[model samples]
Target: MTEHKPGGDLTLGGQRVHERLTREEPDLVARVLARIQAEVADYRRLPVEELAGDIARITQQTVRAFARCLREDRDLNAAELRQIGASAVRRAEEGFPLEAVLAAYHVGTREIFAVGSADAGSADVADLLEVADRTLAFVGTVTGAVTRGYLEELRTKIGQEHTARRTLLSVLADGGPVDAVARSAGIALPARYLVLSVELGPHADEATPGIDADIAIRRKLRRFLAAFEHSCGDGVLASLDGPGGLVLLPLAGRLSAVPEWGSLLGTAGRAAGVDVLAAADTAAPSEVREVAGRTGEVLDVLRWFGRPPGLYRLDDVLVEYQLTRPGEARDRLAAVLAPLDAHPELVETLSTYLELDTNRRRTAARLHVHPNTVDYRLRRVRDLTDIDPLHPAGLPRIIAALAARRASLPR
Candidate 1:
């Protein structure tokens, strides 16, 4: 042990502390390992024999590093810090939380302090203070390095998992071979799958300005879908693409599960403070691209029609969707409704009357008007559009025009 001279510098004090720690290192390491294993639940859960070996090795290495810092009168260099950080990554990979790793460090620090202070018999007060300062500084550096390493490892792991999932989902969405992709993903292909196109309803971002609403909505949807996936024990794969998110949910046995899953997703979206518009179609893995394309069309039609936020299926908007496919057809249909632009109310009456099986009394009741008024609006609609609603041939064209108009309305 180095002799402590009166009025010596901090370096001398550090040397004294280092010598004391060196003599008591074995006992001090044992005490800290015991304290940590007893206090931390994670440590207690680890295999006893293997944990004992790991603790002994780690404690010895850490104590030796601390002793070198004290003797050399310097902080740990980058290499030393990196070593500690590497240990942190390993601990994190072993499923130990940052708190648990930090708690172990704290326990080690306490043990070092207890042993050093006891061995400080009749030492100068200034030397004791210097010892305390150096000890705290050393511990702080180690803790910060370990924290960085732990977080970095976590980020890396998450990024890898995200990339893998995205790749698999992309392949599935592109109609690639299911067996190859599923094997690569290490997940079994479900019997039936539903491809859903999800997006935030119009005006969903009204309250939250200056932020990327689309990204925000996509993130929330991902989280909600993840929870839903866990609840069902089925693999729910999702990816954020061009305008919205695509989710592929696997069903156990029946197409009947679509409504139930859609309902649950609706509830989840509402809870997240966004009105989600989801369009779904069921298909086998090989037909994922087909179903996804159909669902995408459903979403587009819903947007064009300014449909309310909710889950929609192909059957719900088939007519409007089919009619809007051909550009020329849509233009002609728009021309059909052109004459009725001056009589918007007549168009509304015609739509309502057609929806009510052309029943005059029902249409009047729905519009909160008299039956005579309904008759008058129907007459106006026919005169303006040159298509009588009472005529069978004219009624179909009138209905198609109405559908096109609804699909063309701005969202």
Candidate 2:
């Protein structure tokens, strides 16, 4: 088979088309740009005087390059391709979507064909066809180059932003001075902030067997956290580190004003298949590390206790928080509840009784059992653990032991 070449008849036809196009270059360029501006919404939205000047300059350059390629019978070189690609990068930075930029290219191509056809009325049909084919191929090549450049620039910008955000988060997490870090990050530090620790829930696959799966999970978590931060407004900041992440919420007024934070975080966490645990008190910038440590402690206690998946706060589990601190004390408290392990129902009943403030009727209603059954379970618990639920003196130890037992269970 013979190799195909774009010379001979095609080259001769290209030369003729080139001459004709050059003769009508000014009129054709103006018509093509006008059509693009009329058809593409983004082009129309640009400032009329500035946009027209840019279009005119680009159109002239494109027409001159196309004519030269047809006359010379050569593919566009790297320099020419880079010129077109640079235009795409500018369009992307100016906030034009890829689709819109591509649409403008299509409009320009259509106008070029229309103008070529009208101008070449007396020329051979075969020659016109050859020019049309070559023009279309050139457009495709340029379009591909532009798309690549646009995506490359976009990825570069995203990577830079990610680096900056991670740097700021690291400074904050390390308890660095807020004013300097905030200024560097282009953010304002609030007077008070709440720190949250988020992690994949019990159901999530912690040990997924592959680097790819781990990377995918990290990407998913990042996207979810980004969306959550956006929904929480301007003062919210978040960062991911390995399997867990942190979110810092800046409060303008009292924390009481944002009672919905827990629910909102819960909804976001559940949607992302993660659990969110937060510190109870707001911290100043200087105390960020302290609050962050407390948030981690809360997460540890919740994990050890086998709590259900959801949002948790330090204040909500204060008894467990305190009990889990002294390792020996926690062990002894766990031992206190070990005798009731054989009768798990008794432990459950006792927990419910305490939760309902020692009200047998309320505990029964909550447990969906008879009040007599609740009373019997409480008595059994008291006998097995040597801690009376009704006796005021032993109540604190009993409650602490129960909380420790809950924390010690495997989730």
Candidate 3:
């Protein structure tokens, strides 16, 4: 391609006109165009030293592009306009304002034309200036609107990506994040404890009523966690899985960060009318099965012991609960377990059966009853409640009931 010839710097018009265009037009395109050719930087001359340096830089880029188009007679066709429009659309899609970018162009055009017209170039210079003005105005409008449309699509994609990321974190916290793609967000999660909080509040029931997990509640939880992060100090944060999703908080040490977390949780949970349980990692990680198992056991104590539900600190009370039938009543315990004695065998049988691996033969052997006797007792057991003792999950409930029974059992 032939190199374009360079042009003269814009001359301030005699006295009156000189000052008008000089202060207004920063990029003197007319002066650059006068020589019939302009180098890239020739369009960058500015008057006011104001706006720091940004105005000069933006104007420089635009002037260069406009000048290049002028010299090459580059057609601002469907493709170019669409691309520009797409750019504008993308911004709109991103939930950003379009008017700002377009307004800058408006200011830039007035500046360029006023300066350019003051200087002489060709017989058609006036016409060229007018056409340039109209084209840019049209381009600004088209590009801005088009970009917003694209931005709408762009934000939607971003929102989806955010949701997917949240889901992945849920997996990672539960055990591991899975996808065909790579996840390398700059967060470190080494939680010994995992708590899942569902966003709930005056609005929760009203929002996402059918979805089970409310979007607004999730947003609140996210905001709460973000606030909690600084207090977490060495903690890692991931997006909440959803209203029902869990958050994995890897403690730095034995409940090191948990003690400090109450106030923050209190403020956050108050809005929801209930504290979020931040469920235990309802499953185990293949990698840290043992530690996870211990953690799971600790969570069981918290859930069954009837401690108020919002947030519980296991590391501190863990040893106490781990020492016995989760710290229950005996003779003084009968005064303690008098409440549980009302359903004495219900609790006793469950506790004993679980201790014996839910095997009828072993439970019978442990309870010192005939195997048939154990079967009969279990049948009476099933008849009283919806809980199915034969099932493994019944362990948590069975254990708690027994503890409550142990609390109420007679001397």
| lDDT top scorer | 1
List the candidate numbers ranked by lDDT, top first.
Answer: 1, 2, 3
> In model 1, how large is the Cα lDDT of residue 127?
74
Candidate 1 per-residue lDDT, tens place, 1-411, comes to 757533223433345667777888988888888888878777887787756787677777788788888777778898888888988999878777899899888778877877776745455566777677777998899899999999999999878767777777788888677788678767788877867888854335534779786676566655566655665554777875434578887766433566686677666565555578888888888888888888987888877565677889989987768887758888788688788887778878887788778899999999999999999988888878788897787877887777677666765
Residues 147-185 of candidate 2 have per-residue lDDT tens digits of 998998899877876666666667777867667867876
Instruction: Score candidate 2 by TM-score against the native.
Output: 0.73
Q: Give RMSD (Å) of candidate 3 vs. truth.
A: 14.6
The order of the candidates by TM-score, greatest first, is: 1, 2, 3
Q: In order, what lDDT does every prediction score?
A: 0.76, 0.73, 0.48
lDDT of 3 by residue, 15-64 (tens): 22323434444436434233211222322342344223434443454554
Model 1 score (lDDT): 0.76
